[model samples]
Every structure is written in C-alpha cells, then in structure tokens.
Target: MEHTQKLIHKIINLTPLSTAYEHTPKGKRQLECYVKNTCGITAKHLARIYRVRQARQLIKANPQLSLAQLALECGFSDQSHLNNEFNAILQIPPAKYKKLIQQ
Candidate 1:
C-alpha cells in the first residue's frame, strides 16, 4: 500500500498527468487496471484535477489575475472551461472563490 501511494504521488507530482503514464510491457489492459487500482480514476480525469489545482495555486499567488488569464495559464481551453472545472470540483465558481480568498 505504501508503494502504491508513492507511485500515485510520483505520477501526480513529478509531471502533468497527461504524459505521466507509461504502459508496461504487459499491455494497455494492464495499464488501465494499474491506473484504476492506483488512483481509482483515469489519467484524463487526473489531468483535469491537476489543472484545477494549478489554477488555484496561481490564483493564490496572484489574486488580481483575471479568470481568462488564469484559464490560459493553467491550460484550460477558456474562462468557461476553468469556471466549469471550479464549479464541478469545488462546488463554487472561480469568481466567487477568488473573492472569498481575497478576504
């Protein structure tokens, strides 16, 4: 279990989740199983979560940044994309989150 958590952290921290995976010699099926067992989510989903976390960090660093700029910086397609992610993951939109953080 310790090794499993270490592997997950390596994938999550060392690189963006999009390119973090390397399928083993066994095959794609094994890779899929490994991903599911390691983190219970797909790589694409992990990448989205990572992007939102990155956005949040950037927001904290520069509270004056615009949502459009934050989205672009964090690799979201647009402001709405960032907004959707913030709402889905955080249950609050980026604008409101920013406002609360500033207080």
Candidate 2:
C-alpha cells in the first residue's frame, strides 16, 4: 500500500509527452520508476494514457489523423474509452476538442 502511494506520487510529477518510447530498456527505467512510485499503475496503463496525450499533441501538430486511428495508436481500447478518459481528464470530448481547435 505504501509502495503504491509512492508510485502515485512519482507519476503525478512526470513530465508531459516525452519522446522516450524509442528509448532502450534502461532508458525507460526512469519512466517505470516514475510510474511505479506515483500510480502503482501498471506500465501498460501508463503507456496507454501517456500515448493518448502524445496522440493529442500529434493532432494539435497536424490535425490530420482520424479520431479512431488516434485512439487505436494511443493504445486505447476504442474511441469510447478515449472519449471517456479524454473528457475525464480534459473536461471535453475529443470531438468537441477537435471542433474547438478548428474554430
């Protein structure tokens, strides 16, 4: 339990949208350590959530990727899961966000 708390703390302190997916195993340790200490969340969970954030940035950068593809690439189970988390974390659905960006 205490270990989980520590992991959660580390995750909360993590930097945004790092480009470390291509890092070697050892290089990924910092991310593991951070996620371990902060959320006790599985590495897969962290990866999925982090990738979604990355996808959002990619959308912002290009605005060309379809939402379905974005959700899949981001490791979300589907567009609806992406929608739920996107809305929960950002207070807006992806569709709404895309519309807002184009406005």
Candidate 3:
C-alpha cells in the first residue's frame, strides 16, 4: 500500500502529456499496470486530462489568451486538437468558454 502511494506520487508529478514509460524489459507494461490499477485511468487518458486542465487554468487566468496559443502552450498538437480534447474533457470548446467568460 505504501509502495503504491509512493508510485502514485511519482506518476502524478510527471509532466503533462508525457506518458512515455521507462525503457526496460517490463517497465512499460508494469508502469501501465500501476497507472491503471492505482489511478483507474490509462496513462494516455491521464496525460490528456492534465493537458486540458492546464488549458482550462490558462483560459480562466487569461481571458485574452487565444485558443491557438493556448493549444501550443498546453502541448496540444494544434488548435483543432485542443478543441477536440477541450470539448471532450470540459464539454465546451475553448472558444465558447472564452465567449461565456466574456459575457
């Protein structure tokens, strides 16, 4: 249990959108298993969530921030990628969210 907590802490501290497992004979599988078993989510999902969370924070903090810049800043591949992921996670695209914030 203690080991699990420690591992979770390590995994949680990893940078956003970085789900690369360590290079070892079984490192990737073991890390994937640990992430799934402990977090109840896949590593890719976790990374995606992290990126969206960052984008949300940026949007809220800087209402003037552009979606294109936000996408690049938050590690999204492009504006469309950001839109897709943002909509998936928050159920609202960044542009709409910005508009709502403006009103």
Among all candidates shown, the one with the greatest TM-score = 3
lDDT of each: 0.73, 0.62, 0.75
Ranking by lDDT: 3, 1, 2
- In candidate 2, what residue range of length 10 has the lowest lDDT sum? 15-24
Worst 10 residues of 3 by lDDT: 16-25
Model 3 spans with C-alpha error above 4 angstroms: 1-20, 23-26
Evaluation by lDDT, superior candidate among 1 and 3: 3
Candidate 3 Cα deviation (angstroms), residue 2:
8.6
Residue pairs clashing, model 1: none
Error of 2 at 95 (Å): 0.8
Give per-residue lDDT, candidate 1, residue 29: 52
lDDT of 2 by residue, 1-103 (tens): 4433444344333323243433233445665665566667665566556655766786787676788887876656788888888887677888888877777
In candidate 1, stretches whose alpha carbon ends up further than 4 angstroms from where it belongs are: 1-29
